[model samples]
Target chain A: MSSTASSTSTQIQLASRPVGWPTPENFRTVTVELPDLAEGEVRVANEFISVDPYMRGRMNDVKSYIPPFALDETMTGGAVGRVIASRAEDLPVGTAVLHQLGWRDIAQAEASAFRQVTEIHGAPLSLHLGILGMTGLTAYVGLTRIAGLRSGETVFISGAAGAVGSAAGQIARLLGAERVIGSAGSAEKVELLTSKYGFDAALNYKDAPVREQLPELALDGVDVFFDNVGGDHLEAALDVMNTGGRLALCGAIASYNAEEPTPGPDNLSALITRSLRMEGFTLGGHFDLADEYAQRMTEWFAAGEIAYDETVVGGIDHAVDAFLGMMQGQNTGKMVVRTA
Target chain B: MSSTASSTSTQIQLASRPVGWPTPENFRTVTVELPDLAEGEVRVANEFISVDPYMRGRMNDVKSYIPPFALDETMTGGAVGRVIASRAEDLPVGTAVLHQLGWRDIAQAEASAFRQVTEIHGAPLSLHLGILGMTGLTAYVGLTRIAGLRSGETVFISGAAGAVGSAAGQIARLLGAERVIGSAGSAEKVELLTSKYGFDAALNYKDAPVREQLPELALDGVDVFFDNVGGDHLEAALDVMNTGGRLALCGAIASYNAEEPTPGPDNLSALITRSLRMEGFTLGGHFDLADEYAQRMTEWFAAGEIAYDETVVGGIDHAVDAFLGMMQGQNTGKMVVRTA
Candidate 1:
């Protein structure tokens, strides 16, 4: 826990932009020399670093909601760490902090670049990267703000075993959604969704076509859909949505690796015929909901009303592997790498 | 003017449902003898019966926003008529009325079935089917209520020469849209969109692929998209949309006659990456805005702020011809038949 100058930081840098699916060849591990902390600067030793699906979109050279990750730069994303060296009073040494300068074991930046964080209800530090951080906020905002999931409504969530989807299912239930439906890739995850996540029903898309299975499960018709996997999931949701349904387009992990642009849902006419609404959003402007979300989430965490799962990998060297695994649907929930 | 009954009404009824594009063989005309008007009912002499793109969707037996047209029934839609005789005091003789009892020379129904209307600023009764009735109200609701178009935002309208699209372009301009772009199928209609409809830019989709052309015209990216033609038009709009853009899904004339479900947009990932919103709506729940729309449209018409074109066929005998012609992109704005 030395807060000294002249230390070295290990980081994973982008070597080349992948045309379709990313591989280890796309990233290169490098070490950077650190200098003495300047005025208002802080040095953090990361405890855990997050790997998310949206990062796959950023890895491409194309412009998006977030700028593309520049070639030959250290990857950045959500991370939780402890301030080991600080020249600023706000982030004193030993205070836990969260930031975007990730895919590294050490981050040294101005104090303003880091946000102070603390563990809730004795949860692990990785919890900040999962249920208590952007992952949780995404689920909350998609349900309440984007899709406006009302009480007594049924919610259908695609990619239900992943970070955002898993959290969305529990949040929808806690928010008074009468029925929560989820779709996953594996039988184990399908069982977990119903047994552990309070989902009313779950679909293993690998079993039967979602087009056939969804209509059977959603007898009342989905009133709200939190979609993380687009394509066929969107088409199926369009087929069975109730009149005036709402869809929150959070991700399209299904098409992230498709080299060619994938076709969208074929039944979009359902929009006009059923009066459906589909909106896509990022967490940028909705940071104002953080205070409300944190407050409620803190209580829920204490009452044991919220549950989450994480696929953890050891060492910063495996960060890219974790990301690739998550993208391949190998991870059941939030995928994070322990950097310390 | 004869106020007495005992006349016969010429009616067109559905003989068979079209599998794709409708042809005359699917319809049959019948002459029905009229008895004296029953209590609470009125006898209306049809003045003009309207033909619209949406009628094609109703021709299918599949359930939609509006119930599918039943077999062997008169094709009901927008019709304006004069009350020739009435047992209901509210709809006395000489009253001009608009009702959905179309495809006929006369309609006899309860007084409540008709909405009393008059010409605006001495405009012809055809205005009721074009810019002052459901057509105009659709543009108003799509721009204001559904898309939530803002002042100074740019708007792009597909099918800009048709009734709803033509009306949307003018209404967007009046609502303070900084730039308005339109797309039509023919060179003549494209020229008319900018020259007569006040669109800042217009594209002939037939000249080039919309995906290639739209990005050039919508250089700043579209903020509000009022879509009447789906498929390639929707795919193009998805490509050039700005951050936080809104799309109102009004109609999909492009695929209404398709024998099979057509593939949707190929780049729906834009929905998430750009933080865009796409909504589908019908006028059923939004007719409450009709009074507000009527007031504003009447003023625009009176002040010469509205311009419209109609392709009127001679008799109800060509009603099917007019509808087929409109579907073939022949009509500039409203298409109607003089039933009387």
Candidate 2:
């Protein structure tokens, strides 16, 4: 139904694996000639591309739930766009889709690799990359399924102003948590946690040790700890967790780029003494809950019971920058590169 | 009900709280006058007394699941014996009973605190302290209910020569595990794991780092990790765990007496990438499964599908020595002091 005559594409490639923290030199931008579409292939001009903390772990040449980002190849992640060219009958031109062909403005892949998204009447298309996408689903699955969050329970979240953490704070409140406490890196983020994200109490970890501050913030003790930043935050949460508490470990952003093995929480023995349960999970294994999350998330958004933030960095040229910024805690919520 | 003419009883009392490792001087043995049985009380002459790892935690003056032992008070633990003098109508003088008033020759407690144990036609009374008791039930609950052990799954256990660990090796086999590997502190204990307990492979953790030995022992990677010794053994299990692996943390005897905080596993980040689960539980939280565990364990014993051992230290005077020795890994299966 629609077509665009584009013969060239610009993409970011992982030139070499970084030693510790990745630098701009570790990535390279390249221009490549586009080829004609084959049968069952669709060409998409991406509207929004996600840059998440998990990508930092994939930058290393180590095996994980998802494979490492190969050298000299365009990095892949969640992206949403309109199908500008289609050789398949089922996914015709002008179809809105979501696919894993990010780090570039234009993507040509088999139609089956992309899934068509039904537009939310008034929501932005980029919401699929943040609140209604992997980030929001990760926060939901970790709280309801992994931690089994109950009403009248206290919850503590690390990286509380970031994408998944921000959503986790709100979701825990809606799920009937009696008190929600959060930890962030700066005073501004701490204020936003209570004023914007509805956290009962928020602390700036950089101001003091989390172990000493957590007990004071969580007056009654935390029943669920949704961990995003691991190292010290995890250790602190373990110290103040209530008996039979649950920890939903979504990310260890604190140690993702460390050069050497980081020491784990010293208070892990608390798990035994308190009979706690700590479960680590990735979003891919829990796709079965996506529809349920979307339905509930959509309803909450409609009723103004949910809110999300995005730090949009303009252009595909800045995709690597956006990723690096997200890893460095430069974003308040989801960091997405607007490539169109 | 016949009553003994003896008016004196001897017992061990905690003299001073230990800082790092406990010593003989920390306990004292003294004689106390025995009082006549009250309306609802009974006098039990213990046949066997248990000295377990969990007792080390209770010795410290800190809050835990169980209250700490008070200064100058007699220590308490599991014991099996015959009721000597009973004033309660529910319990007869000659009834076999299991109670929590050990570390002494004679224990006088309310009849409700002691439960009657129907004598197994041919089993020794000591089996109530090892395989058919708390130790055996711990292994069953951790493997079956907590770890959710499945058939054809490789299982690894740390401190696999101790009471709970020894029973865990056999229980994993009976539960249809594909491979069962274990680690102990010495060669003799390691040998017992394979020869007597039917472990597929056993390692002496003292000879080499568990992290180096686990990969070779568990070539296919481990699905369930029954943690009895925490520190290094837990770290090693985290390294080679299969995706979606389950770790049932039963005890952390390795760091039970540490004066300073111990560093936990450095590779805990493996939890996130592998989508692993680590849950800590105590036997008290799982008493509901006692009957089920006893029935299955008894059946296994009858079929000759299970084997167990006990390191008995004779006489009540040696009760403190037995407990100290057990804490140092001196005993094999169950460490019991026979007072009769």
Candidate 3:
């Protein structure tokens, strides 16, 4: 095999498994030597590496809907990259592409697995990973399919400043929701939700007790609750949900790391009284709906009806920090690592 | 202003609210003279009264989807009765009807509030409160509407011997569920679930640990979990739920009498992992779907594709004991009181 001499690659692999919360010790930085492109294989220099809450669940060895990340393997994620070399007719060199390229500087994969991105639509490449990609689809399917969210209904979203929640709020508004309320842990996040993301209202969960603040924020009561944080936030949402409310259980970032799982508040009987519907979902489960979501999201983005934000870290070495920070609610929007 | 000479009207009122679990002392039996029927009014002798778990939440003076039961007032419930006198054209004497007659022997109400129950159907009057009424509707809506249950999905129901759970298991089977598993409190109740209600398997939760037994019973893993008891049963169901599973939250009998709300199991994070959907619901909230459910249930019952059981207590004086028995898991099915 003819080897490539100039291909650059920087990657992060899982050094060890985390017992509780992940630390920098769990990751290892490695410089990989790139191989020559085989037939139908392409080399991608990643521009933006995505860090998400779902990754934490994969770090554990327990069985889940998706398999856990094996120790010493490259930590995979959604990434936007520029094609530097290609041996396929469909994708030529210099094309911008999006793929599941772990926390890496460069990658070599079959060209069919990578989709070519075009700026002809006047959208940024990173948008492929945030508002126009899995994050956007997650919000769409969870709200429309799982929650059965109807137009003119009020919505409440937890972790409202993060990637999926941010996309969810804007998408909810575009779908003709009457009102959208969001909860984040910081004042800046609260502000970002309402002002930048077009949320009707946003609350800083840290400043006030969520149980009390939820009712005040949702005076008319919530019709749909999109929960990303599952501990106290779920209980608060349960308290304020109106009869026949739909709770879209998207994520539970709040309780991912404890040595023992935290117990939810004892208002479960409310389900029977209000006739609420709470559901959990993953983007991978709704792959069948991808085409439909992509069409709607592309149309919305093209019309300027929806917008997205991202916090891009500088290098692959900082991918672990970015992942950790995202889990700690430190990022304002979608957290991504730039490796190229 | 003519008044009836008879003092045959007897009512049971909430004497005092219970602190944790209710007792017989919380109820009071009272006899009052009947009033003359006003315009559009009907006087009915209640034959059967329903004692349900939802009533426990109503005793509390807090804001809920349904109003709380006022202290010293008759406790309200769905009851079957015979109209003795009427001043409205829609309802006439000797008509068998269904109405929300609080725990009372005789009640006066507008004729519009009651629905005529024709004996032409061949179903018993008590079926209006159990399989043919709200209890059956609860099961239908939870499984079909809320859970979006599909054919061949494996179903696990808690409180499988109770009115709602019993109906849910049978309906799930009739809807083409591949396997229906149920958990009840007694060995005899478990037998009823399998032999009578058509559940593929049934386990007496009081006899063994459900967490261990659940995985064994649901060999293919559970796709829809119809939760009636919400403490450990809910937690156990969460553990075994398949990817994209849906949990229909019907009731939480386990936590109804809990003085302090029990903390939910630590395994709730599984919601994110499995992409499970858990929703709480009340039959009244889905009233819009009732007509459809009624039609389906009637056809199913006529075809002998479904069956129901009820534990009837004879007389108003036995109402409290019957309710206590139902709560203590003594009743094999719905607990109802027949008053003369």
Q: Which candidate, 2 or 3, would have the higher TM-score against the true structure?
A: 2
TM-scores, one per candidate: 0.98, 0.98, 0.91
Instruction: Give candidate 1's error at residue A27 in angstroms.
Output: 1.0
Q: What lDDT does model 2 reach?
A: 0.91
| Steric clash count of candidate 1 | 0
Per-prediction interface RMSD in Å: 0.7, 0.6, 1.7
Ranking according to lDDT, highest score first: 1, 2, 3
Over 4 Å off, model 2: A1-4
Give the DockQ (C-alpha) for candidate 1: 0.91
lDDT string for model 2 (A1-340, tens) is 2435465778999999998899999999998988888888888888999888888888898889999999999988899998888899988888899998878888888999999987888887888988888899999999999999999999999999999999999999999999999999999999999999999999999999999899998878899999999999999999989999999999999898889998888889898899999999999789999999999998999898987888999999998888888888889988999997
The alpha-carbon deviation from the true structure for residue B73 of candidate 1, after best TM-score superposition, in angstroms, is: 1.3
Q: What C-alpha lDDT, on a 0 to 100 scale, does residue B310 get in candidate 2?
A: 94
Overall lDDT per candidate, in order of appearance: 0.91, 0.91, 0.85
The residue-level lDDT of candidate 1 at B290 comes to 88
In model 1, the clashing pairs are none
By DockQ, highest first, what's the ranking? 1, 2, 3
